[model samples]
Target: MDTVIVSSQYQIVIPQEIRESMGIVSGQKIQMIAYRNRIELIPLKPIAQMRGFLKGIETEVVREGDRV
Candidate 1:
């Protein structure tokens, strides 16, 4: 795991290797969530860019007769 130091202003810069691997560009918006005792950052992509993200997923789950 990579370690980062928080600056005096409570801001931490993401490492360059991680940023490049995750395609995190400057000005890209990230969603931060405080879960339990850790923080999670999720990259937000535009709607147009999110198209077909779930393509070819399994959709054959059995359902109740009345659920449909």
Candidate 2:
């Protein structure tokens, strides 16, 4: 795990390696969530970029006779 130090202003810069790997760029919006005891950052992707992300996934599901 990469360790980061929070500045006096309570701001921490994401590491270069992690940013490059995750395609994070300057001015890109990221969501911060406080879950349990840790903080999570989620990248907000555009709708166009999210298209076809689940292509070719399994679609079959068991159903009851009445439901079918």
Candidate 3:
């Protein structure tokens, strides 16, 4: 696991390797979530960039005859 130290100013610098692998660029918006006892950071992408993300997923589902 990667470790980071929180600065006195309550800021932490992301490591270089992690930043490069995650494609995290400066000024990019990230969502922070506090779940249980740990924090999670999720990169936020623009809506336009999210286009076709769900392509090729199965959309058909079997339904009861009455429902169908």
Number of the predicted model whose TM-score against the real structure is largest: 3
lDDT of each: 0.95, 0.93, 0.93
The whole-model C-alpha lDDT of candidate 1 against the native structure comes to 0.95
Rate residue 61 of model 1 by lDDT: 94
Ordered list by TM-score, greatest first: 3, 2, 1
RMSD of 3: 1.0
Off by over 4 Å in 3: none
Off by over 4 Å in 2: none
Reference-based TM-score of each model: 0.81, 0.85, 0.89
Q: Where does candidate 2 clash, by residue pair?
A: none
**Model 1 CA deviation exceeding 4 Å by range:** 65-68
Tell me the tens digit of each residue's lDDT in model 2 across 1-68.
99999999999999999999989999988999999999999878888999999999999999998995
